[model samples]
Target: MSQTPPSCPASVEDVFACVEEHTRPLSVEAVSLESALGRVLRERVIADEDQPRFDVAAMDGYAVRADEEAEWLEVVGMLRAGDWQPQQLEAGQAMQVATGAALPCAGLRVVPKEETERTGNQVRILRRPADTCIRLRGQNFRAGDQLMAAGVRLNAGHLALLASVGWVRPVVTRQPRILHLVTGNELVPPGQAPGPGQIRDTNTTLVAAFLSEWGLPVQSFRVGEDEAEARTFLAPHLTGNQPPDLLLISGGASVGEHDFTRSLLEYYGFRLLIHRTAARPGRPLIFAVRNGTVAFGLPGNPLAHYVCLNLYVRAALQRILGVEGGLAFAEGFLTEAWNPGRSPWETLCPAVWKLESGKAQITLLSWQNSGDLTPLRHANAVARLPGGEQPLSAGSKVVFLPTHPL
Candidate 1:
């Protein structure tokens, strides 16, 4: 391991730009209609047939041919929804039609049942019906109409439209296969009592949850503190027949003696893109790529892990999948004053915010340090505080990134 100190940390924007420039969108795959929700569409979905497919009744009424002064008409037939057979409507004749039923005769106007009196196949018109109630063929959409454009993230409504257009499966961008390696002999699995100088392995859970939220598959493994053991455990995964598209290493990314993640990745021919970022809570974040697979060495601290995953990991995934990614920021006023620390790095402080009378009111959570995760339980957002020693007062406008939408 040739270890001069790692390269100087880069700005957050520069890191994002570098990752975006290096990562290419994954190829396409065919997924079942039911499984396509939340996946990015790779192909434009065009209508296979016109919506409605035929002229149909839009209301429950009587289908009749308009005449100059026809006050009474003979009831010839009845049509309900899904009835497609054609029925003729002669002069002075009408047919009972239900909503969504195909019109029995061409050029016939439907008079709502409430506008006419009906008794024993005989009907009396009470009012003149305006325009026809028949929904024309292709009224909603034509056969060649584009229903959904490429690169759109499929949602419930989009799936409904696809089903309506007879798409049982959709072409979507293939989601990356992610494998996580959480290291540290001092970390014990959750549900087990931690020994002295030990803590629960929360980073794995955090990384897994974030990956699931981003619509990626999660496969994880636990490794011990030995550098040789860690290297041996990860070597097969790096050069397998079906290696993961992305590798996430949690806990061993910093400059400590046990922080061999970067060195191991370098040994495997992975080129480091950015070894560190000028951001608080996650300055040791490392990004590298090799053989078309990207690896992110996230910090071990739980709070730092959360921030780096949200900021950098999420951005890399979005670029790889060709989907809209990055933190969505909203302008809001701080409910209390905040004094930025003396560190030169930009700080991301946890906050809880809500809309009050259409205005965003934000309150900074009581944060002890980046190692503390308790404050995040009540925080839905993080306020980006500048590096200078200025104290931002209450009611000051600040931009915040929501962990979940407000």
Candidate 2:
């Protein structure tokens, strides 16, 4: 039986919970460490061996007994990086060790070259500074120590750490197959000059860039306003063995006469779970599913698309990638007095923020309406303003989410 779509939730946070119930993590695969960035790690990465493998010098200095009372010690040997020579250091002896060279013995201190004067065969300890410039074995991590837990998203630093532990090919959740359809006869490509009653489409580039943050690829196309033709164009994709894992249709999500996203998804056997949201600019958002594939019908307004993509669609992608937990909102203080105006619904306003002395200070940007996209250029974060009429003063605490791609 076809399921009826639910009514809009009272809060934007509930919308996140509704879509999360229908999705699960995609299958996992083994990929090279180089290609693992932005991919959620599926296995526990442990230290293959003690990090550094041995006691190595942190810098070029003389390795000597910390309590050596010799006026001048013999230069036993010169050790460079990758050279491991274990020679016992007596009370009157020292080793000239280069940066990253293995220490000859324990109970030794590294006197920096700046604090010592070296002669041809004998070096004089001009000053015996109490400093140990050695990177001890197991200091960073010990053998079998858990370096990364499952479900951690791998970044460049995480990849390097994995490679150092011999994880050349790490298992990660596969990225979802996304099919994007832009619906509207009045929409034209960004390069083309728009005629009367037509506007250039910006949702394609916007959606692509957002997906690239997680290294996911999107297949995009334009479907006209005619519901029948749009169904015919998308019917094959839902039937084939390699159907998209997630479907996104830009525009046609409202209650207008031309809005057909809800009916079209039903005809394709998709169960509409959500038809609207309680957030400003993104109220007409649609979330549906067919079997395991998730779908979202975004509003035609450019800013609405941006807002929905950042909030709801992002939540779905997180579940599919096996990233644990829900959408996290951080607290920030407002830098200026502003108001999103009086609205019964939650407002997801765009803003720019920076950390000052470890505290987030936000400056909310303004927009004429949901159709406005110019303000997004200055927005690096999204601020959640609860329904109220009072203007927020400077340094008022507010919740926000950073919109960084990485």
Q: Which candidate leads in lDDT?
A: 2
Clashes of 1: 0
- What does candidate 2's lDDT look like per residue over 1-406, in tens digits? 4487665453686777777788999999999987888999888987879988998888788999878888688998999998878888988898998888989888888888887888897988888655587888889989988999888889989988987888999999997899999999998999999999999999999999999877899999997889999888997888989899999999999999999999999888888888887778898888888888999999989898888888888888889888877777799999998765677777899999899999999998899999999999999888998776877789889999888643
Q: Whole-model Cα lDDT per candidate?
A: 0.82, 0.87
Q: What tens-digit string does per-residue lDDT give for candidate 1 at 1-406? A: 2234346787878778878877878889999988997898878888878887888888888888855358888988888897876977788888899999999767778888889998899899898667777798899999888988776778889999898887878998887888999899899999899999999999888888777775677898998877888789877887788777888998788889879988888888888887788888888888888878988898889898878776677777777776755546789999999888577888877889999999999998876777898987887777777777888899999987877411
TM-score of each predicted structure versus truth:
0.90, 0.95
lDDT of 2 at 43: 84
In model 2, how large is the Cα lDDT of residue 319? 90
Where in model 2 is the C-alpha error above 4 Å?
Answer: 8-10, 340-342, 388-391
